[model samples]
Target: MWRSLWRSIDRFSPQYFKYILNELRGIKVVERSNRELVIDILQSMVEIVTYGDKHDPIIFEYFMEYQVMAEFVRVLKISKNSRIEAPLLQYLSIMIQNIESDHAIYYCFSNGYINSIITHPFKFEGGDLASYYMSFLRAVSSKLNRDTLCLLVKVELVS
Candidate 1:
C-alpha cells in the first residue's frame, strides 16, 4: 500500500510521512510477524527522510515535528530480540547520517533519546547487532561538529 503510493507520487508528501509516523506509533503489539511490518515502516521512513533532506525540507520538518526518533526509541525499548533491534539501529544510523541541519542533529542527540538507545541492553553475544551498534555510533560521530558535539556529550561544571 505504501509502496504503491510512494511510486504514484513524484515526491513524497508531508502527509504521507505523517501517516507512516502514525503507523509507527500505532504499534501496540510486536509479534514475530509484525516485526517485519515495523522494519518495513522504518525502512520506508529512512528513505522518506533521506529524500526529504535532499528534495523537500517540509517533509523532513514534518518528520521532526512528529518526533519520529522518539518513536523509534520506544520501539527499540519494547523489542527485546536482536532481529528487530538490529534493523532499527541501522535505519537510525542512516537517518542520523543524512540529517544535514544542526537543529535536527541537536534534536536527534537531545532528550537522552540517542543516549537511551546507546545505553540499551541488547544481547550481542554473537550477531550483527554489535556491528550495527558500531555503525550507528559512526553515523552519529560523522555528524559531530563544534556546534553539535556538545549535544551528544555532557561537560558538567564542578562547583
Candidate 2:
C-alpha cells in the first residue's frame, strides 16, 4: 500500500505535486481538530521527507532553510492533542533540534548520493538503499545525546 502511494508520488507532475503539498499544508493547519487526518498527513509528510527528494539543490536548500521544519512544527502543535497516538511529533521535534547541529549538515553532504536516490529514486540503478538511509540516520544518531535518542524512539512508540 505504502509502496504504491510512493510510486504514485514519484510519477506525479510538478503541478500535481504542488497541489498535494498545498492540500497537506492545509490539513496540517487544521490537524488539531482532526486527529485521524493529521496522522495520515504526518505519515505522508514523513514519506516525502524521507524518500521524496534528496538530490535536488532546491529541495536541499529548502530543507537547509528549515521551512520544512517550520511546517512540521505547525503539524506538531496541532497534533499535540493526539501525542499519545502520534510518535511522529517527537521524531520531528528531534529532527528540528538536530538540524541545527553539525551532524545534520555533515550527513547532508556526505549522504548526497543516497539523498539523490530519495529525490529521484527512478535514477537509482541499484544499491542497498535501506542500509544507506539507516547508516545516514546512525551517523546523525552518533552526534546526539543518549537522552535525545531515547526520546526520539519513545515518540515513535507512544502512539
What would the per-residue lDDT of candidate 2 be over residues 1-159, giving only the tens digit for each residue? 778766644522333334545665776344346766655555554444443344333443445444444554455444443431224434443343345434344444342322332243221234444444445456455555654444333234555
TM-score of 1: 0.87
Q: Which ten-residue region of model 1 has the weakest summed lDDT? A: 4-13
Q: List candidate 2 segments past 4 Å from native.
A: 1-17, 28-33, 52-58, 62-66, 90-141, 144-159
lDDT (CA) for every model shown? 0.83, 0.44
* Per-residue lDDT of model 1, residues 74-140, tens digit only: 8887774527888988999988888787667787888778888899988898877899999999998
Query: Candidate 1, after superposition: displacement of residue 53 in Å?
Result: 1.5
- The clash count of every prediction, one per candidate, is 0, 2
* Runs off by more than 4 Å, candidate 1: 1-11
For candidate 2, the 10 contiguous residues with the lowest summed lDDT are 115-124
